[model samples]
Target chain A: MDFAPTPEQQALREKVVRFARDHLGARAAEHDRDATFDESGWKACADFGVLGWPIKKEYGGGGLDPLTAIMAYEALGEGCVDNGLVFAINNHLFACAVYIADHGTEEQRRRWLPALCDGSLVGAHALSEPETGSDMLSLTTTAVRDGDGYVLNGTKKFISNGPRADLFVVFARTGGDDVAPQRALSAFVVPADTPGLTARDIPKAGLRGTLMGEITFDGCVLGEDQRLGAEGAGYQLFTSTMEWERGFMFASQVGVMSRLTDRCAAYAARRRQFGRPIGSFQSVSHRIADMRVRLELARLMLYKVGWLRSRGRLAMQEASMLKLYVSEGLKTTALDAMQIHGARGYTEELGIEREVRDVLAGTIYGGTSDIQRSIIAGLMGLPTAA
Target chain B: MTDDIAKTVRSFIGEHVQDGEPGDDHDIFATGSVSSLFAVQLVMWVERTFGIAVHPTDLDIENFRTVNHVVRFVESRRAAAAPA
Candidate 1:
């Protein structure tokens, strides 16, 4: 069967590739070293509609189809060299913006989405507390109701976009005291300027350019109107958004995988060793070949997921498979990228190592590789051992 | 689902599951009894046939591990969604 991208998709890819090259590629190394989110560069992405590609045009988004949006995002990864900025944008879009789109009431969408779309208001998801990352069901965060408002109290760790998030999609327990948390959780849209909310920058080994931080809500007050869905539907909201995030966020990495291979190939061909290009070596050529295999294979899976999502099909299984495959593929590909370039790949000046470090997190965040496997196995109806 | 419908659902998994032991206790997802993609399809089939929306919280190995477990879960959901 023909798998060629359509002419329109090709044009979209070309345009995003050009934009990313012009804005993010040249400055990738600088931003990597700064350990700060590229505010100016991010706004540039917004202007290019990268921030809102998946969202509807009514909300000031590009209103692109799922497959087309991901294809464009993959192209952005190919052109842009800053993985951190890409991640920050992905978090803003898939995790934060999507929640409002799928579940928010009309007034909520009207008030929050336009600014979020245009990049006026940065967004972040604050669910990973120090005590709870994957175990969201057991999180201690509470939004106890008092009159028409809820008072929030909790702390979230390793939050991407925490420092700059103008709006937060926060999760808190709100069920009756005797009720189990499955029906007790609720989600809200809390402004960053809320009196009791505070965020502190978290230092890290990589992707530091996207400010990760610890977010604390000490009795922060929010109106009932701030609730995105029914009080008990917070868990459902988070789960749905998470499914999208796990499914679509890896689109950029597929693009990044292409970039890794290209970078390695160019270096292998031009960089002389033993009076010949390093790529001529069997070992080096094989690594690059393996990298190529991963790129195409992972791309196919991601495309299937993107298509399924576009069709409004329930893609729980496809998303898990794609997430598991692509995240691991990126790490392995980046590792080979480092190996192919030798010291050049490892050096911070080239920003290649930073990409590897960024890829390292793909398996950890958005649920760990272990977690993906569990989901995959669970979906397979297989036991834990399998 | 009625007893006959429940038996039909069980038989579908029982017959198709590669496990092939054809017992009531066959583990579907974990045993390679069926493909993971089938679980999604089965979930949809259960939802459409019974008109019950399975909550995400209900999606776990505990309830979905075996064919019997799945049928029982579907029955419970059908009962829960039954009109008063």
Candidate 2:
């Protein structure tokens, strides 16, 4: 149960902090206001080897282990004020790239990994549709067998990086109504240049730098070689990938929570209130203290999931708990910062209001707070379902 | 072994699963009583109760469509794991 960071992890954290502070999120407010994806920051991240942190060296990646990757991401979150940039990186690496690296065949890995690592390609996961969010089996996306390939027809909504992604990890139904819906699903890797694919930007209030969009696949044909895993294996692949998504994806948000707390506490101390510092007030100080507690516990939970992953053990329950905790914790802390900073927080100048907007998406993505609660309860042998 | 596996699976189903009936092999997925979330729990239960791990390849809905299928999957895994 050691909580101390290794020397290498400490150094990596420092390096990431330095890089992120110097190179990323310079015009975060401008980008967020315009709902624009920061291409320059992304290129900087690629140059810094951020995209390849968890991938293997053979695949043109840094090959960092799960724990080290989490540490580096935490540093990035702390140093980079652009939550949207971090969210984009998270979506690319965990949600899309890792899918191929973990489940793709050797041929598939060789085909896309180098480009993915070098930032020549951007990746997006196409799972959610107009009709589905968490109910994956109910998705109406279909891939019909045609000769030696499949033709896909579907519309994926609320996709991160969709507008600019060069590649997509798409989940669609391949089996007929006779098969169970869960068993009917299959995943495919589709390039954006495919003849029948279109991605339209869907402007949103937060995570604007990630470029949320809707992807439409109309008779988009992919060869049999592009299918990930075997037929009817999409459910398993998605569930396992979600283990990574729910566990490691939010480690950066834990870092964001820590950063927000420090900012709030400093504001509470330095800002003059009725007589002296606002920190002298019990209500304000108590909220700051609560944020500290949440940060500590959230870090512990995040690290526990990383540790479990490192040991090749199952972390289904822990991942759901961590995802739920860190997400909600960040939201609470962000709102607290807003309240503590008063008008300054509410104003866009201080970026405190932006933090609130950014943190609100946490409880909704990956899996909703309600969905996580259901997962936790179901794991506890309760009859809960999401 | 089969009886024990069935009993354990039945016990879990009766306790945690909504609208589950004992001594029946009704298609849980077809009925919508077993959701993806419940399916994960069911897999974990099979692993813990049978002392065998359910690999990703073993996660096909066919393996968990019914208690009878689960018992068979567990038996096959246990058999494969046993010493020659």
Candidate 3:
């Protein structure tokens, strides 16, 4: 198999890098300090065609293939230092807008995709309630049939982009027996302005620039057209979207790892102790080496996932494997960078500490590390209860 | 074709499931014959063995609850895929 990127892919990466360096993540420290969402940075990404990179061009998107999109996201992470903003864009594209594009009817796509592609509507995924984090099948959210629509009632906690989203793809139980839990759920594309829907920002230790929050839907009414796919298809919809979320969403994190490696290597070479550069010492050099190793491994797995998706193949196993590797690998690399930089790394101004904090949440979100492990094992013909 | 599909499905069930001699119409989920993970495995097997891609809308338990059901589901999918 050919491992080299085409000229077009390379050009796209270069263009994204240049654009991100010039336009995105300006004053990231201030946004992180205040735990605020950077609307300007988001608008810049939307304008740069990042929000619709994988969507069809007819819907006001770039319609790039899966591999090209991964390259662009990797370049975005390498060029733009704002991890939170990148994450917000990923959540919006993969978790929310993808539902409409992949599962929505022609009318639904016509209604939502253009607005979502442009900055007219921000998107968020409504899953992971306070009680059900990884236990998605047991979600207590209820959507009962009304006259011609459905009324949704539930609380979705730790939702990325919750505070600023204009549209939310909500997963709620519709029908099925307790024994057959997988068939009980359904997906809906609900507007955030629905009468009974409330979004409140929850301040967190990291990824603060992307507003995370709890959204309470109190008898929120949605029309019949809002339903994605068929009734009792929410779990399937979620499982299908998860390959993107778990695999391609972490493409940016791979870029972050590469950046951290470069930064740490430069710092080690520049910083001298006992009349010689710290690179002279094996301890410091070994950490740098490990950082490089993790970056390479993460990139390989991530690109493999992209290649698989580009071919319209099922990558459930690879996606789970990549999700577990990249997130945990980034955390380790970030910690290594912190230790190599010493005091400067711990300081807020250098942003090494922020990187550590930001990457720490990677293992927890987009399905936890534990959940990824379970998924990997289960896919391997090993029976698991999860 | 039905017999072949049923044999393939039964072998998968026997490999993962234990402590029960389930009938052809047994509720695989309710009877604890298979967990959700096995359900996914079964889907993958059906797709690979029969060369039929099961859409997300067709992932209902009614189609996968038993070996007999799986055979019927595969036959229907093949029929649908065939030209008039």
Candidate 4:
């Protein structure tokens, strides 16, 4: 029943917020305008140990517990204005590094985690293909077994941090038609420098600083040791690990919601219209109030998922609900902030427009809000069409 | 105890499978009797029903391929969790 953070957790959150505000996102406008990655911000976060908050210390990480990590990341989102850079960091940590930490062998962890934590290497996840969006089981990527290795061939699109990533966690089918669909695929940790592997940037409307890319693996050879978990266990690994991707990744979005709410409230209190502050008007005041409500509910859901995960418990259903609520909540809060700010929000001056564009993709990535709804229904024992 | 565990698992599987109740050794996955999502649901159900934690290392399909396998997994987990 206790909702308050421990003193250590509170201290870590304050430290992360301070570090983020001081060192990161200084050139958010320039980066957003040119569609460039925030190199300085990335390096600063690495130097500050933002990259390894949840990883085990034995593997060169800070090793903060799950709930504590969520609290710190929420602070990062609240203080950092460059949403794209935070998105990139989340992908690196949750999607790629956490995959290895959770499922990799001891040797793999010893080999990969230090570099990822120290910022010498970047990480990305390659799952969605040009043809496959929500239907992961239908992805056409294939990895055929060779002597002591496998030859992988596939194309992954919309990969965050892909252009600069030194490593990728790729999923491809290793089982044949005879294999059950649930056990048809396998995951591999593929180095970016492998022969026949190439990546090209794919620019988009938002989160431009993250450098989304399309990576193609053409007859790339991988040792059997590169496999994550067991053969034919990729689907299971993905389903189990999705709690992190779907739940923890959105901790920052809830932070964004709180940030937007506070920003709108501040603007309404100061901005004058019709001889009074905008906050005096019921329409403007009500929108800010609604934004606050969404922020509160989203944080509560995020914390519940964190708590469940911190105890090594199943959180698939709760994660889906959190993903659906926070993504949609942040998007509406951003748009409402835009409306409240009127001209300033619509233009590039206040960065509200970028916030709008950034939050727009939250509902699409990490499984769409529609897909999340279906997952929630499926978990509730209701018949779903998968 | 094993019989009770198997019966409970069979009942759960029967609710999802279209073809009548499967035998103890029937491979539900190979028979295509349930959707892929059921694999996840089945894992969660086992944990909740048996009051055991299914760790990441235990995500192998072999462990829950049939009623017999699930019964074994539950029994093994319970045994491991027992005062030792």
**Predicted model with the maximum DockQ:** 4
After superposing candidate 2 on the true structure, give the runs of residues whose Cα lies further than 4 Å from its correct spot.
B1-3, B13-33, B50-84
TM-score of 3: 0.93
Superior by lDDT: candidate 1 or candidate 3: 3
Sorted on TM-score, best first, the list reads: 4, 3, 2, 1
Index of the highest-TM-score prediction: 4
Against the hidden true structure, what lDDT does model 4 obtain?
0.91
| Most lDDT-accurate candidate | 4
lDDT, model 2, position B13: 74
Q: After superposition, how far is residue B76 of candidate 1 from its true place, in Å?
A: 17
TM-score against native, each model = 0.85, 0.92, 0.93, 0.97
Report the C-alpha lDDT of model 2 over A1-386, residue by residue, as the tens digit. Answer: 78899998999999998899899888999889999888999999999999989999999899988888888888899889999999988999999999999899999999999999888899999999998998888899999999999999999999999998999999999988887666789999999999999999998868877898999999998899999988887887898779888988898899899889999888888998688998999999999999999999998898888777776667788899999999988988998899998888899989988888888899999989998998898787775544
lDDT of 4 by residue, A158-260 (tens): 9999998999999999999988787789999999999999999998999888899999999999999999989988988998898999989999998889889
Off by over 4 Å in 1: A383-386, B1-3, B6-84
Q: List lDDT for all candidates, in order.
A: 0.81, 0.87, 0.87, 0.91
Between prediction 1 and prediction 2, the one with superior TM-score is 2
Candidate 3 RMSD to the real structure? 2.7
Model 1 interface Cα RMSD in Å = 9.4
Ordered from best to worst DockQ, the candidate numbers read: 4, 2, 3, 1
With a 3 Å backbone cut-off (N, CA, C), the pairs that clash in candidate 3 are none
lDDT of 3 by residue, B1-84 (tens): 677778777777767776454667876766544565677677777888889876645656678878789889999989998999
